[model samples]
Target chain A: MADFLSAYSIQNWLESCPQGYLEDTSYGHAVGEGEPGLLMDNEVLRNDAIRTTVQLVLGERCALAASSGLINAAPDEASKRFLATQTLDEARHVEVFTQRLYDLGVAKDDLESVLSTHANPHLVAFADVLLEKVDKKDFVAGVVGQNIVLEGMAFSVFEMMHAVNSEMNPKFCHVLSGTIADERRHVGFGENRIGSLIKEYPERKAEVEQMQKEMSYHMLATFAAAFQDVEAINELEKIGEERSHAKFQGADLGVMDPDEMEHLLADTVLGEFKTRLGRIGLEYQTPVAP
Target chain B: MIDDVHELRTDEFLAEVHSFEFWFQSIEGYLSDSTWGHDADAEEEAIDDEDRDRLISVLCNYCVGEAAALEAASGMIQIAPDRHSQIFLATQVADEGRHLEVFLHRLAELGVTDADAEIAKRASPSLLVFKDRLLELVSGKDWESALFAQNVVLESLEFVVFRRHAAEADTITSQVLEGVIKDERRHMGFGENELGRRLSRSPKLQQRLRDFRPELDALVLATLKETAHHLELDAEEERVLGKGYLESVERLGLLG
Candidate 1:
């Protein structure tokens, strides 16, 4: 009601989106090239070898990644309602993203292959370190881990994506915007309740932060490893263009060197992570700025 | 088949509650100022620094106490349905009642009786946000919906909102947080866990988050703004608060 979203923030986010730019083929669309566009034309999609492998992965797991059928195990009523809403939200998300993957030439599994390249292994430690194997006291712990911790941070970034990339292409704009609305609420549910818990329990702050770091660090590996591959790197660059990261605009990303795009994405992501952590009085070691 | 309860508007509800909140604030104003006209002779000696500190803690702790019960009830309601949800919500109301009693007793023990009439009378920045949250919940009808409205929304925000003040507060504040935190944890756990589970079941249920995210974020940010004002925090302090809030959400895996 009172300039809530901050005019500059909302406007700038919407203004910088890269919705229609993924089709650019300049600079060979190679992964490491400094060009801000991706080479997503017939040349890139023509390769059948990698395309087959991609198809297999997508077919096996097309379901939205979330905890949907867990209501009976809910520890309480309010929680049950919240989960009900969240499951509905994810189902919609899966539907929307599945559609988006179809529109893209990469196919679902191909998309997964592209995405899988960024997979990180540290998710286990984060989940295991803080939560016990059996949380019989209330509900299963993994849902809590996935929905709240992972999705929470993810909501903001996705909103960031929708805000930054929606303008690039009409189709992407639709998917990004529609998908984002769902994530925003999903993330909100996780944040609002959890916020109260931490405020209520100051001491728990330490453990929560520790667990978050482990999870985020593992997630980082997903991004970090993929950035090295030519195809993955190219896809990321294309995503940057497709998503139209504001920094990729015109001749430069406003960074001193074009080579710094990798650092820019990497550092910016991590920095936001730490700042998010600090908002709740939880402390965590931020990766040293590159 | 479900009719959206969020469709309920707050004009009627807020009209009723805002007056109470205003009354509370007017009384709080007296304490904040140096008027101290209430029955001083009863507990004059103890009302010194330590007494004042303890009293503040107790009052806030009372808030913390109420918050705890409300949270538990919320978690219960979110996870259950029909009769059980109703039962949990009712019990939660009772828990809130007890907390009110304890808070009032603590205030009286501190020789602070007059504040009650003014306590909810005039809205402070903090009260306004809290009041908004409360009215929103009730307006939604059925405490199950309200539980989500209150515990998941208001109470959860209050935990962080109150904590900032408690962090620098006297014994009562810390004590309040200590007591409240235990209950609050389970409350949030229930909401998050239940939501996750339901999402696992049907597509319709999982989407509640996406639909509600904007409203929730706006509400949260508004609440944060109100708390920031009440705490008299500057930009840096606000950023610190934001950092803490985001970090807290992040840690809980609440944010994605």
Candidate 2:
């Protein structure tokens, strides 16, 4: 019990976070690594990059709101403390992604406009479904939605982006690396802290599963819309052809189609959700394919 | 324990207060090296069980208050007027979380078996009044009122209480509170800088704040009255608390 407490302690967080992985970091990436000129200068690639990053920003914004709103509703000090750290991590995620917009050439004044303009409606619905649980102060449902589902999704998505950008975009890849680390911690907290609570309130399982199904449907739609962007994919391919190598989750992005990449990401995320949910004694509810 | 209040209206001051980096650095400086049982065993043998129980009771109430602060800080992030304020509130949430955790850790060290039940049992009616009022402000979504209630009203009360207790606290508790005191000071600075500016500009908002004060003041007095025996504060410390609370209110431009 002491070990569990110390592992999740704020002292551990401080030592592991700012003093550890985040030292000397500016906006979750190295200071000197700027966006690649080829992508920044090309109009098609720049818009595509901005479009992709806007989703990240919007997703992180939801994460920020959910994590913050769940703190007071947490049943124990440990959960409250973990959610508090998660709130800051989500906030940092928002800031870093919003910074990426500027790095991709969106003006500060135009940020909100671009975010709203580029935000996929399906993604917005996804956030709304999850935030409703948070707003109602349902810690069980909210954690499932935010930590298990949303963060689970973000973890895989970030990993995929990190892989593809590792060879081409050092700055974006660095940013994703930090967020991936943060998301891993958030998901772990969800599993460790909420498992007992779920056992205590076994009836909450059905309601949580229903919420997960609804959220999963919207998440799938979001992926569908994102992957079906032929123009962006073609432009990305053009840029990729010029580069040497790129891989996403071990699949060669140089030859893998957008649909295949989307499937890979979706499968990875859903697979994580199943394993993590089962660990906490909940069944995974599969949503209708978008 | 801020001995003298600093000027709140300078661009340099607001810039630093509003910056996330400033708060993050402050957190690392104060808390990075400390943990749950950092100095517990050394002090555990010195303090008697009755004293430990008294400390645990006081800390349980603190846990409740810190939880309220965590909730309020978390909600305020969304309604904060700008990116800087939002970012600052983010760090504030983390600070409140750390405060709550350290207190809980102390309770556990005191041989508390069930902290949740102990907290529920030990939290005074006065503390609940204070928490309910703060949560009311947060739920109402009046950003300025909530921020003022939290950063000014609640934080000022905590500042005084922690300062008073630090003198008599066992070594482990004192070390933990020394870190929390620094955080509360930073919170008070933010309230003074932010609310002082807003109150100076808007008479209506000022009046709303004025109307809200009596309830918070009543709660504070009731709380100090209730905890005074357990805390072992003397008349001089009470005088200091009264002076400090008034100074905090005055700094927020609430005084004539």
- Stretches of candidate 2 off by over 4 Å are A1-6, A236-244, B1-19, B37-45, B48-50
Per-residue accuracy of model 2 over A1-290 as CA lDDT, tens digit each:
34564577676787788778888777887868899887878898789899999999899889988898888788766777878888888878888888789888898779899989999999999999998999999999999999999999998888888877787789888889888888888888889877888999999999999999999999989999999987856775676654334666677866777788789888888888899999999999999988
What is residue A179's positional error in candidate 1, in angstroms? Answer: 2.2
Q: Judged by TM-score, which candidate is best?
A: 2
Model 2 chain A: lowest-lDDT 10 consecutive positions: A236-245
RMSD of each: 19.7, 3.7
lDDT per model vs. reference: 0.42, 0.83
* Candidate 1 TM-score, true structure as reference: 0.37
Cα RMSD of predicted structure 1: 19.7
TM-score of chain B of 1: 0.56
How high is the DockQ of candidate 1?
A: 0.02
C-alpha RMSD over true interface residues, each candidate? 18.7, 1.8
